[model samples]
Target: MKIVSLRVNGAGQAFIARPGTTLLLALREQLGLTGAKRGCAQGACGSCTVLLDGQPVVSCLVPAVTVDGAEIATIEGLADGQVLSDVQQAFLDGFATQCGFCTPGMIMSAEALLDRNPDPTRDEVNEAISGNVCRCTGYEPIVSAVLDAAARRRSRAGEGAKL
Candidate 1:
């Protein structure tokens, strides 16, 4: 086992990752952050998605040793103490989540897209979350939620602008 340090959820964290440990394994098993799920153990499924340096990446396919000192953001970092992020709120209020197996990765993709383009078109939203698979929701609600999140975030930003 070797110790590797990475920034997770804006905090510096260290964990022991066995040889060839995947980031998903370290996050879930070692860091106690289960937001990033382990699905295919390959890059095909986006269930293990996370924001690495503000870009969405399939955590299960990422070697823990390769991402040392990287900034990782998971679903756990989306909300404040009581206040949820615009995306999180949109997902909840829009009923975008069903079985929720893919919620975290979906949210991370939405978050990255919004960070770069606060107002993304439906096609953009679809493209952003295309990697995620949610058998329960059929993706209609998920797309709507991402668009709604963009609107909500813009409204919030406008409110801040006026203040």
Candidate 2:
């Protein structure tokens, strides 16, 4: 086993990984961060989505060795203490989550989208979350939640403009 170092959730973390260990396995099994689920081991499912170097990627498909010393952000990193991120709150308040198997990936993708475009349109939101597949909720609520999160982020930014 070799040690793989990473900046996960804005914190430094190192874990031992065997050859060919996927990031999803390291995060879930080694680090005990279960937010990113292991759906299809293949990249076809977005359930293992996480931000790698600020870009959304399927953690299940990424080898731990390849991402050594890289920055990673998972669903666990989206909250502050007991408070939730805008996307997470939007998901909960908007009832966008059902079954929640895909919620973490969906939220991570939405977070990445809003980080770049805080005022995205409905179509943009749809495109941002296109990689994520939700077996329940039919994606209407998910899209709406992403749009709502954009609005929330924009509103929060506008508050700073008043200062």
Candidate 1: segments with Cα more than 4 A from true spot: none
Give the per-residue lDDT digits (tens) of candidate 1, residues 1-163.
7789989999999998889899999999989999889878988879999999999999998988888889999999989989999999999999999989999999999999999999899999999998988889889999999999999999999999999
Query: Model 1 has how many clashing residue pairs?
Result: 0
Backbone clashes in each candidate structure, one number apiece? 0, 0
- lDDT, candidate 2, at 38: 87
TM-score of 1: 0.97
- Candidate 2 residue 69 Cα shift, in angstroms, is 1.2
